[model samples]
Target: MYIGLGIVLIVLGAILAFALNIDIPGVGDDTLGYILMAAGVLAIILSFVATRRRPAGYTTTRESQVDPATGSRVDHTDIDPR
Candidate 1:
């Protein structure tokens, strides 16, 4: 959803900069279009970064966790009952 919006903003900015040949009443040729385009691209990139993609260094290791009730090892394994 946000990615689509970013694409739209980026495309709109590009069009305004290169294709759109319309001049505002009190705005110069180089207005906020470039800023908008940059913002759009940044937003897209941020959305991608904000995804649920974990890095490579993430692991299920617990070598530094300390128990409060008792000084024991934390067993994270699963067991089955018959």
Candidate 2:
């Protein structure tokens, strides 16, 4: 998701820097565009780093047993972190 957002920001920045000619009161279009592009690159890099640091999978367990006194069956389920 962050990667996609970064790509979008980069595209928008490129359009602003190269295609648009409108001027802002306090900021330059090209300058803002370059800033946005840099931020986008940063976001994408961070996303990749975060993904690499995350666990690959979770552990799931299921158990079943017969209660001798009650003559009934019990079921249990659990999920464990990687």
Candidate 3:
């Protein structure tokens, strides 16, 4: 979601900064557009960093098996270290 928002902001900023030409009393269109683009880039970087820091899902289980030669049952453990 955040990544998508970042992409949208970047596109809008580019359009505002480069494609359109307008004049405002106090605020400059190019300046605002650059700011938006910068903000979008920052959001994208933050999203990437946040996703990288997330912990992966994991599952663990135990299974029982019988040994043919010994005629004995053995238990085995399995773990996912994601």
lDDT of 2: 0.92
lDDT of 2 by residue, 1-82 (tens): 6999899989989988999987898999999889989989999999999999998889999999999999899999999988
Q: Which stretches of candidate 1 lie over 4 Å from their true place?
A: 52-82
Query: How many clashing pairs in candidate 2?
Result: 0
Better of 2 and 3 by TM-score: 2
Among these predictions, the greatest lDDT belongs to 2
By TM-score, rank the candidates, best first.
2, 3, 1
**Model 1: per-residue Cα lDDT over 1-82, one tens digit each:** 5798899888888878777778788874446578678889998988888774644443343345558889866656433332
Candidate 3 residues lying further than 4 Å off, grouped into runs, are 59-82
> Cα deviation of 46 in candidate 1 (Å)?
0.9
Best by TM-score: 2
Candidate 2: list runs displaced more than 4 Å.
58-81
Predict model 1's lDDT versus the native.
0.72
